[model samples]
Target: MGMRVKQLSQLRNRIVVITGATSGIGAVTAAKLAEAGAVPIITGRSASKLAAMRGRVSGRCGFYELDVTDNADVQRVVDRIATDFGRIDVLVNNAGFGLFERFEDAPLEHFAKMMDTNYMGTVRCAKAVLPYMKSQGNGHIVNIASMAGKLSTAKASGYAATKHAVLGLTNALRAELAPDGIAVSAVNPGPIDTPFLETADPGGGYAASVKGYLLKPAQVADTIVRVIAKRTPEVDLPLSAGIGIRLYGLAPRFADKTLGKLLNRK
Candidate 1:
């Protein structure tokens, strides 16, 4: 293995609540966690997807079709997790998706949906599990974000906004929950080979452009498991992509100009 597996005995039996576990990074990560000895509870809006995932996981995993945008549903499922599993050691707020419409040209509803799923979805999960984690005095929250959070994209403006919100939430929650022995972290990854590419670019343009740079969902998932397995506060899936995120923040205009040239933007 190219990644370092930390010697953490607390990984097994650690009730891992994962959102967006239907497919992509969430699906792969849940399986990996189970293989490494974790009781992973997979959640997704697609019942079929959720069922399929639970069926395929490495162990006898639990399933929940969760709509993170709804507070009542989020609460019910969270309560069930605590009542059934007893204690939650990890919460992966990984459910998110977006449409690529021009920022100004798009209707306000588009942005609202992005916020509901990406921002509020994350907040809902964190809040639902916070009491349990705080009471136990130990937990880890992993927020799945994108390099877009630190960088930017013309066609992906709404998605970037949501991911940035995730990053912001993760950072603030880390400081707020530190005293409670809870670790909050954000994972910023570059383009990955998954249905996300299809969702983000239904026309397949995202793939056409990011060709050689696209990383595998399993690879990203592996990193996610390690982050939780070791309780790392922040994780950058591929260091190169993280550097790009950092550089983009340092010079937004330059990054924008560079991306335009790279993607042949008009």
Candidate 2:
């Protein structure tokens, strides 16, 4: 364990840029990365939360108030980071949200907003950083998707669509950037215990049902930190969840009747 910590600490001074980083998995990952001696540059839509996170993180840290949907602003921030930090070694696209409601009941605007922030926002950030990472000849991009991306569940249709897009991007980008020495990885977690549920499941039904199974933010953060070190291709949290996803993939019709019904808590 000491040797492992030593190995992880080799990231001293490494610049890691994370989006949607003021809370939840993103926020925890920022602190963990800093603990490993890396410089975490956190971005989020909330200035006060960003400031609070900056204050809490140890070692060198950077916090920016950002809305992922703003392409111009994203580019500006990316440019500024590249200029101020000199190089961005890692990018974690964790900025996203979900709203749970039956397809017919959910507002169309909510779907648009989710798509812009969750899918297009990721695209924008990746595009902004690609030039710098490519020029540097190496970098890593870790996208935070969800199990919903792999297995569609009821009441989260819109949210699932956005994550599906992110997963697709992660896979294709991984293959495209391999030769450039830049790595792309996808972290698909199951239900997480965070403020995310407040927004995704405002009615509290889904959260209540999945109470026992929700993964902790710190646990997911540890996985993110490990992915940074290992440059892993893809990771599905909670061994059981991954198994469920695989089973669903193999027998969609059966899963639709069994696992799908069980997962339609929202």
Candidate 3:
């Protein structure tokens, strides 16, 4: 673990607050950060699951029950964390879910819910942590966006919109926070083998079609850990997916005919 140690050296004793951390990528990240000597503070809607995560994570791991959609709750939790930790070194906004439904078939409430939870939830948490980070003179904010934000496909218009908002917020915050010694990063990962797929594609057809390309939760968790250490601006995973996003941007017509058609499997 020499290479791993070198990568995580900067994180020793840092306090990392991770939202939606009871399972999946967030869960793995908490454990990995703990191994790197960072104090991992996990949050989720389920108090029971949060306790379980604290037990599972190595070393000192704290947890809080958080529902990011609630603005007051977000402020309360973040304040409590800051008071306990003295300073918040990093915040990973990973609390989000997706649903795949055609624009015409999807209910308006679904889109609103996604926007409220995925986008506004991030806004609330980021705002809550600002004063603490600003006072400390340094901090990192990592938002777990998605490839769909860049390249929207069929049956995911609502979900894609939410991710797109997250990406936009991340980019703007990076610029705004630079002078304050704060770094913002966006992790745009493709499909990962996690409960996320279960919610996004309940039928499992999309997962079945994309099985070979699906990334493991740890793969994304590792990237999140690295980005915190390096403070990278943006990271798009799975070289192939990155290539497709680039190709789509460069030649939309050609990509739509080839890559877009292939990816519209959902």
Candidate 4:
């Protein structure tokens, strides 16, 4: 307990930036980091929603209006944060959406939007912060990927594609930034009980299938905080899910048949 407290104390006053912090995992993470005494810098597209989230935080927090898909805007906000805080200790790229539909039925525009916001948005933020982190010689970049990144399902083709890209980017960045003393990590959480489900699968088909296995936003936030403090390379929430995904990777044919039966996939 003593060591744990000491470890958390290390986050005190650290400038931790979280994107998409107005709701869901990002919002919960901001509050959790604030409890650990870190100065949470939050960004979201909604001004009123961001203000409400800031008001809910216990400690001093900064909020910015940002749309991660906008490269210039991402750079501007990151620059302002770096200037205001002197250095950004950590960045959590959590601003992304999901579209769950069969590949044939999915719209092309949705594919473009997911790639732009989910994959390239992460790239923009990481690129914007790298110079500052390189100058400081120490920083952490945490990408909020998904279990889908590791394994794709029937209706999540587009979402999975973006997450897979995220995983690839994160792994390569980890190798590239290691020499600079900057750590890169990926948090691949299974389905969580949040507004994301509503947005991703408005028809409720996928949500209903995974309702029993859904994790809480706070649970994911706790994992994010631990990942940052420990500099863990990759983590999948709910060990059982991670184990299943690993097994599937080892035996794709057998696992796909089994998972298809279990998930009622066509």
Q: Encode model 1's per-residue lDDT on 79-171: one tens digit a residue.
A: 998998888889999999877777788789989998999999999999999999999989999999887787666777888899988998889
> Quick one: ranking by TM-score, best first?
3, 4, 2, 1
What's the TM-score of each model vs. the native?
A: 0.93, 0.97, 0.97, 0.97
How far does residue 50 in candidate 4 sit from its true spot (Å)? 0.6
lDDT score for residue 20 of model 2: 96
Model 4 error, position 165 (Å)? 0.4
Weakest 10 consecutive residues, lDDT, candidate 3? 254-263
Q: Report the C-alpha displacement of residue 108, candidate 4, in angstroms.
A: 0.7
Indicate the residue-level lDDT of 13 in model 3.
Answer: 93
- Provide C-alpha RMSD values for all models, in order: 2.1, 1.2, 1.1, 1.2
Model 2: residues with Cα > 4 Å off, grouped in runs: none
User: After aligning candidate 3 to the native by TM-score, how far in Å is the CA of 117 from where it should be?
Assistant: 0.8
lDDT preference between candidates 2 and 4, better one: 2
Clashes of 4: 0
| Candidate 3 residue-wise lDDT, 1-266, digit = tens | 78767869989999999999999999999999999899999999998898788677988868899999998999999999998888899999999999999899999999999999999999999999999999999999999999998989999999999999999999999999999999999999999999999999999999999899999999999999999988889999987888878877988988778776578989
Find the 10 residues in a row with the least total lDDT in model 2. Answer: 257-266
- lDDT for every model? 0.85, 0.92, 0.93, 0.91
How many clashes in candidate 2? Answer: 0
